[model samples]
Target chain A: MPQTASRPMKVSYQDLFWIFFKAGMAFGGGLGILAVLEEELVTRFKVVSREDFLTYYGISRIVPSGSMTALAVAFGYRLGGFWGTIIALTAMVVPAFAITVLLTMFYQVLKNTNLLPWLEVSVLPAALALILAAAIKLGKDVFRPSAGFLLAAGAFAAVSFFKWNPALVLLAGGLLGIILFRSSQGEAK
Target chain B: MSLLSFILLIFTFNLLTFGNGPAMIPMLQADLVDHAQVLSIEQLLYAFAIARVTPGQANVYVASIGYFLFGLSGAFLATLAIQLPGYIMLPFMRTYERMRSNAWVGRFTRGLTVASVGLIFAATFSIGIKTLGEPVTWIVFIVTLLTIVLLKWNQMLGLLLASLLGILLKLLL
Candidate 1:
């Protein structure tokens, strides 16, 4: 809700390339890049307004799954054209993914290890708890003395007991929301 | 699964894998676990756990599945599959913004969020069937749930405590 207004600055593709290349020439790596990006992207080059960044960020956060990559693509498209999309995406993804791949690789290597069962045994219950907690929290927030309860219960039964495809169920929920919630708001008005 | 099917599967599911990381469980479980038998619920949960602990957002679970099934190229492909939705949906961002203030859009989003939560609840049932195999794990789960929902413990800490409790209970009993 707090808005930070950003003024966009004029910088060419050549300026962008020099910022990256000469920053490497001058400021050094890892720690210095943050400063460069803050100076250039935030204060100097100023590609996206803060509102634009936050709006895209909010969209990425609210939606499921690929928040990070989504933001990368969004920002990339804003900063450059098609090639900018590729470079920004790669820059954002590659290093962080080392962390993602490393543990999974270990999971593969440790599959037959005597320690894995112990790891699995410990992790299983924790995973279940996490899932249940999210359900309880969201349910508490979403459900009220209304059709919301019916929708929630319907969705639960469809997926859990009746074995409906969750994607279809989600589409159904959206349609119902349009019909159900819209009419209720209409009545209140 | 064929490589193409795998790509299609990830792409389709990521579109609906809304709300949060945990909301993803039932959808992933529905196809990948129950139908295809590609991975067990436990393995999937482990991957979920790893994704939670690691950097980035929820996409890592897809990456893990890809890596588990078909190695590095699979990981790359899965990453692309998951990322595709964001790209496809990008142009509509302005349309979404225009619709944001409409009463119908709010209701639509509410419907989506409520159903996503419902999916998470269903996940608790389906996953609980496989996960709560022993009394200790059940106890660990319940205590962890209480600590999270009631005592207001943070998710990461609660999970860490629950896993540690599981290991401790295993050693003791």
Candidate 2:
């Protein structure tokens, strides 16, 4: 059985905001943001044990929204109730929001200049590379040797080649998984 | 667009989105860029790149697009719209946890996870078709792929190097 902490840990809203805000400013993406949050909330502050932190993190992934923000809200609620949830989420998003607005504003100033075209067009390779990397990483995780491979390939072809709507493709995949994994023999994983 | 319309549009998108930012990209492109003509492909990709290079969630890129379409207020509204409905739904996850032990829910969850991987791939394919053509671009793309995917380098470092390579390629070749 998992051991629970002896007493409840006290966490201030300011700490939640600053930790997540710093995470927002420093990390590159969702997974990175989650990692930073774990470091601060679990390892450093001991506000939540590693197990609870991970449980909330897992919940964040299965939910519909952005995983990082969801985790922030979950963790906040865990520690400080409704207001904490609101404060943590706001803190997590604000830095990203501010930077995005600033970047776009700079883009407006630069768009008319020659440098703008050069930067935009030239960055295509980098952008595409990053996208491909993400796909490959996610693909490896979801694709098993045989059954998963077929599902992933089908989903890829359906969307990329036939240009089927992605939402439909996902539903089909889910339905197929339900059928395939329904059998006892298919429960190997 | 008016703030109400902007909020409605993004809220609709966020409500349907499952796998976060990457999954949201293709839908946003089709609706905002192709159908609505709110922004051009170049601008969309530009915002994507900015989101990539910056710290935090890639969804922030949507705010940039909102800024392009309707200035500062649009940006704020767009961010709120993309997040609010979805955030509201998070509290319901407690209920979901109880239902998760049901057979169908478990299967559906697994399916969504697997399908999300494919969705990410499809999103990349759609974007790559437009961006990758030139020989130098292919070279840069391959190098980046090998470094990041194969060797497992830090993403931020990889992006910075790729950006420099982009500049150098533009200047020289």
Candidate 3:
């Protein structure tokens, strides 16, 4: 990895707010945020270099909490330091929070009425299917006909069949991966 | 559940889990639903749907739960609980990078990432068995899965189509 030790461009709090606010509103999911951030932060404004941004993103994935939020923190710190971190994170988070709460209110209105069950019947399967698709995609991406496959499959069985707590499964899987899949490179393949 | 406990629960999970949005779903469900009983599985499914349809982090779904349970204040609390600890730890981003290439950390992260998929699948299966009863739901499920896997459609668009199909099915049948 090429480490660029250059000073960051000075971005105003308002500028950071609107930039990430736009990103927050435009992108719909965690992965999509990367593209939008690249466009706005790297290609468009040149706030952060592609290498640094990607580095932050990689770190974000390894740490706990939401990946996007983690990105916001790192990117924000890169842009403006501690206060920048706060503003950038707020910008990124507030839009989604507002939207979710609005929808929750809508759900509340519909919850007590006869319409709630109907909404559930229609939405739940699609949501489940999306998740199932994600699982399949992840398996295809991760499994290489080795111990990785076995670990993933075993984790699945533990969680699905045995009703094991996911946190515990994840902990055990990490330990197993350490013991079994050592000497491997990172997740990038 | 008390507001403080809710915040503590989300904060604790955020501090611990190594993976991203979908991975947190199962843990959140296990805590808020199975353990706390603050949210029913059905309500949790609806919250998951709302999170799916909306923008930003999927943990916004947990904030939605807080909103549902206690209104705007609850939403703020929950979002803060989940987000603040991670943000505060932003200074440690460099620290994580230092340990990034460590053998054990790499193995742990790989394992955690792979297992997260299974945990997400577990969540999906649990919800699927309970919610996907109607034939129309099955149709939506199949169609959405095919649209995503075969067509390589965008996820937000896929979710929109699924939501519309759900509404249409409810209207038609």
Name the candidate that leads on DockQ. Answer: 3
Q: Kindly report which residue pairs in candidate 1 clash with one another.
A: none
Give per-residue lDDT, candidate 1, residue B67.
Answer: 81
Decoy 1 TM-score against native = 0.55
Report, for all candidates in order, the number of backbone clashes.
0, 0, 0
Q: Please, what are the lDDT tens digits per residue for candidate 3 over residues B83-159? A: 77557446566664556567667676676666765554555566677667767778877887788768978755775
Residue-level lDDT of model 3, residues A6-110, one tens digit each, is 554667878888777866764336644554575568766887754345445544555665767878877777677788788877888888899888878888575
Q: How accurate is candidate 2 locally (lDDT)?
A: 0.66
The C-alpha stretches of model 1 lying farther than 4 A from their native spots are A1-111, A114-116, A182-189, B1-82
lDDT of 2 by residue, A5-111 (tens): 34465667788778878677643366556545755776568776543443354455556677666776677666666787788778878988988888889996755
Worst 10 residues of 2 chain A by lDDT: A1-10
The lDDT values for all models are 0.60, 0.66, 0.68
Q: Arrange candidates, best TM-score first.
A: 2, 3, 1
lDDT of 1 by residue, A1-189 (tens): 111113242655556555443222211111122223333454456664432432354355445445545555555555555565566555544543565567778885744445444644575576566656544543564557778778878988999989997667877876787777766442211
lDDT of 2 by residue, B1-173 (tens): 46677668776776667436666778878988888787798888778777765667767788888899888988988887765643643555555455555777667656655666666566667667766776666776777667776887765566568767767877786
DockQ of each: 0.27, 0.38, 0.40
- What DockQ class does candidate 1 belong to? acceptable
